[model samples]
Target chain A: MIRRLLLFSLLGACSLPAQFGLFLVQNGQDVASSDQTYGFGTKPVGAVVNLEFHLRNSGADAILTDLHLSSTDFQFIPSAPSLPQAVAAGTALDLMVQFRPGKAGAATADLIANGVKLGTFNGIGLASVTVSMGDGSPVPSPLEFGSVKRGESSARTIRISNGENSAVLVNVGTRDKTFQVKPGTSPIPIAAGETATIEIDFVPAADGPQQSALLIDQLVFPLVGTGLEPPFPPPTIDLDRADLASAQQGKLTVRLASPSQATGTGEVDMDIQPSDASANLDSGIQFLSTGTRTATFNVNQGDTVAHFGSDISATFQTGTTAGNIVFTVKLGYFTTTKTLRIAPAVVGLDSSKAQRTSAGLDLLLSAFDNTRSATSMTFTFFDQSGTKLPPGAITVDASAALGQFFTSSDLGGAFSLHAFFPVNGNPGQVDSVEVQIVNSAGTAQTARLPFTTP
Target chain B: MNRAAVFLLCVAPAVAASNFSSPLVGLTGDAQGKLHLVHGVAGSFVVRGAIAGQALDWAFAASGGLLKTADELRVLDAQGNVIGRRTASESQVLLNPRYAFFPETGELWPASAHRDRALLIQSAAVGGRVIALGPADQREIVLAACRGDHLWLLTFDITSGALKHESAPGGTIGEQACQAAHRAALLVLEDRVLLANAHEIVIQTSTGQERRLPIPRNHGTRIHRAGEDTVEIEMSGAPSFVLRFNSEGERLYELPAAEARP
Candidate 1:
């Protein structure tokens, strides 16, 4: 009899209706209380949607003990009353619910009070904006702009499409001054389903790779680019002749490995340093212009080589006294120089001494010439029979052989040229030798010297 | 003070007779006889002695003294002998209270105020390169820079690291302000900007009102702030002298170069 009594009480509790239920409220007026589900409508992601409702007590006086929301996207307005409040019968309490979707998709939640279902909420979220390359290609997270010349600009365009159902204002910008958004590309409202283009320019003020970001609303797109040094490299100056002669006109060829990509003017200066204090370099060196200590050469755009006089080679006359000329080519931050050792070109053979050994005849010759570099020295040998030998004449490249001797360390004028010659075969067979010396300017020959066997 | 009393008070120590007779050469031939400033001082002063055969473009009073040509910077001692030297290719020179600025390198020396050893103050903060710089006080410097079509006036506080910027449209006044002759002819106060040239001194207020004070026979002149509301105009001549004036354009007194301390 007791078990039957408990079962009756449980059945009576299960048959009772909920005391609190929620009713839709529109524009501060009661709309309906019978609908099971309420739609919050579509909203752009990151936007908020608020739905007003009234929590009405329809059964009897009850204490509202608890409230729960099923989804994190939904929340109760902080201005509402606390839980555990007593509600009189037939009375209604105002309540506000807000839904904020973080991503594009369908969102839903359930409203429950005191272990009883009040209502269900649903909404749709849409992406606010879409971004892509100007050519309709997906933009990489960090858009890379290869190598851009320093002090120059490279531009690219991107398309920003609005995916929202209503017009929305969008702002796009970069924090770095090197990366700039072209004018008239931002701060404009984009209509729904419409697209706009933004031209971004990367003008690196300095050299090296730089990283920055493009901010569109709350979204950040990374960007990267490298600035290359100016394309103009130091030029190379080559002299027509290795050894320049005093009081003589010579050619200097200015060559550049690459073409100039910059527009403007550049100059090449000739700095002269003469060992002789009385040497007047200003009056001697002349190219491009006359009677000037420093000669100027101009470089134009797209020119691989600079022209001074008539061609790539500039004609400059050396001073009467020997000296060193430094040709400096300057283009922006690049500077290159070529030094030419100028000396008198006179060549002479002073004396020749010969000795007989077991191997052959060794000859020591001494000569004095202002220009130490002699182009060639020829030795004509004759046997005791007075007939030319098998190897008629042995020629030596004096200039190449003496190149190592005359270096930047040499500072004296009218240097002496010393040379050794060894004649093979029987020393007794060698009788006489006539030597001829040749240089850039004048050539000199020596009288045939007689040799006697020991 | 009377001119005689001021001269007696500010008379410099006895210098070599050769110092006054030597000829002064400018960076350019045309710049000869023009007035220049010795920045890097507690306050600025005119260079009294001649710097002959140096072909110097500008000079500063720091680490004893420094003179710069187009390609070299030479440090001089109290006895006027070169003690240090370095290769420096600079286009413009800027002076502050304690530091001197050289071109090709945008940095302040003595390395006391900044880190990273570089400051873009020339371009980023001023909108262009600093053409002229003058001391406002012990820790403040007033500078001028030129941008696209505007001239900027910037004041920097050394201790607090605060910077104030003002700009005006470029036209006739802007061109005169940038000239090398008027490099030290700018004085910025709390409410007005003072710019001086050979013929007149222009006073421009923050409210955009402009006033002018004619300077008679003031061919080579430089303007400096003597106090909060007073300014001094130094005229270059046989004997350079400073003419003090109030903000109302009233002449206060004249202090000759011989009487100037720094």
Candidate 2:
């Protein structure tokens, strides 16, 4: 084993020639080994200085195999070629070394190639520019400005200090127009050991989350903020009439808090709940002119009220069953409610009156059903000879009477419904009229009333 | 295989390629009523035949003979060359009348602020919103929209700024058919209004006269107006075919020939 080790060492020594030597080039020319010291001059800490050295192989072909530096301050940049690179005789190999000193002082390192000392790398490191908050700590990467109202501005101050012996001129800027550097000069200079303030205003033009970044020389600091909507109070809901009765349909208006001051548009979801949970309120409360059980209303900017139906007021109906209905509306973070009480109905058809005019006949039917409980009302016209007329009979059901029925002045606790019939050719076609009212309770018929077409 | 099958195979790639995907983006027309069916993904768009005799390939999707991207809007001639461009606005520019869509606030404005400016139009309204603008006349502009389960038609008068609207029933013109056009479609010529759903086509007049025409089975999507009055309907399968109608709304031909007004 001792003989084998001696033979291997002799073979390694024989592979290298006596004429083989290495040299570094500066200013495009070769420098002798004793005069080769790469001086990086002065640079700020955390700043990198790259020095390219032309390595000339004067003798036979040789493999670089590996490269090492004595001090940790100097390193090879990522673009440098890999190890074990071959260099032919009379040909040159360009090698690069990066010096990034971490402290404010003189730094030196030796470059070793294939176990041979090639040259010394040296540089003077100075303090870099410092970016910080008002409390004198390093600035965080992403500075959050919380929520800023739309059409309003929120300002923040960032201090930039020059720690190097020389001054530093920085251009404080961001790509986003929402984040503006206000009342400050660009390319502001800070002298050594001195600080300069940059006031950045986050003026949100719209409502939503916003993101941007501050570009300070080669460094990047992120900025984040949210544009909030102005305080939009919940809409005020009101019914057209105070007395809400069963089977009665009316308009419901949802007015905005302040129409002129509105800045943004939004939607409000409506949910209707009856006092009796089992009772279906789907058909009871309709909105948006399409007759939907639940709907979302749009409140536009600078509008007097939210859109409900085809207009600003929605159409709501109380079905046959009388009770209280609670309307709950949700808008953004707010939830509000409005309750409507419906009165029950008393069913009756007391009397009827008929008259004739130049156009035709007008009939008035008096009933005690204030809630329009009668599901169907029919009218039959006859001639003076007691023969049924050619136009047959006409009927008015709950769908029609729900909106037309009104309180009667002739009878106490009664409502009246009016109907008109036209005689086209002859003025004396219809002479008498008979009326029939039907509901779930019972059916009632009124006697024929005499009528003359004048 | 067979002589007939070889002939169909040779002609298939001239109009459609298997690269076509759905749902369709938009269907627009030129001044002469030549229809352009826009489909496929965003960047790799496939516009099926706008200029006459041009091979159907992946190209820019058109809107009223105009092309738009995220930053610029270009006007393309019949030979598919850019004639004009409008890149100065912060809002999204749309052609035919040059409307601007602001992204910061969801609002639309006329580029020139014409007297017929539609201020009440919103990106989304209470019940429905304006989807597509159809052919305009001397005094009015027709808009097709989706309301609830059906399709609706709105006419905006230019001089008076009055808007009149009407809608068909739920099954007449379904919202799905309306939304697949990226919204809705209405072909107008003077007082005549023509619109179609998946099942049928409806023609209405200003005097309240309406007529319904049933579409043939196996027709997939319908695009109105190939010439002056033609309706081009596509049938998608292993081999797709385009069915078209005549001006009198009486004849049906395969592959080409289309016309219908209102």
- Could you report the DockQ of all the candidates, in the order they appear? 0.01, 0.01
Please identify model 2 stretches exceeding 4 Å from their true place: A1-50, A53-128, A147-155, A164-167, A191-193, A201-211, A225-231, A240-249, A259-285, A300-304, A308-310, A318-326, A339-454, B1-262
| lDDT tens per residue, model 2, B195-220 | 55555556665454666766644334
Candidate 1 residues A1-454, lDDT tens each?
A: 7885565455434432387778888877766646678888777687898888888888776666667778877778865468556666798878889888755557888888867778888986655888899998988889887789977888878888988776767778887888898764656578888998888788887788988888776567888999876767567887888866553456677777778665444566666676555332133344423323344566666788876544566555453335677778676677888887865555543234455657555554434344544566676667678876645655655554344433321212222332333334345766776777776567777777677443
Q: lDDT at A312 for candidate 2?
A: 71
For A200-298, candidate 2 gives per-residue lDDT tens digits of 889887788899988765467899999987666567777897787653455677676666234444443334343344332233233323334355566
Best by DockQ: 2
TM-score, each model? Answer: 0.29, 0.35
Per-residue lDDT for B1-262 in model 1, tens only? 1322322221121111211111111111112422232111111111333333343333322113445566765554423345665565665655432344653454544223333443434445666666555444446556666565346777766444357646662444565666667766765554566678887777676666766776645677665433222354555542232333333344322221322221
User: lDDT of each prediction vs. the true structure?
Assistant: 0.56, 0.52
Q: Which runs in model 1 stand beyond 4 Å of their true positions?
A: A1-127, A233-368, A371-454, B1-262
- Report chain A TM-scores, every model: 0.40, 0.48
RMSD for all candidates, in order, please.
29.1, 26.7
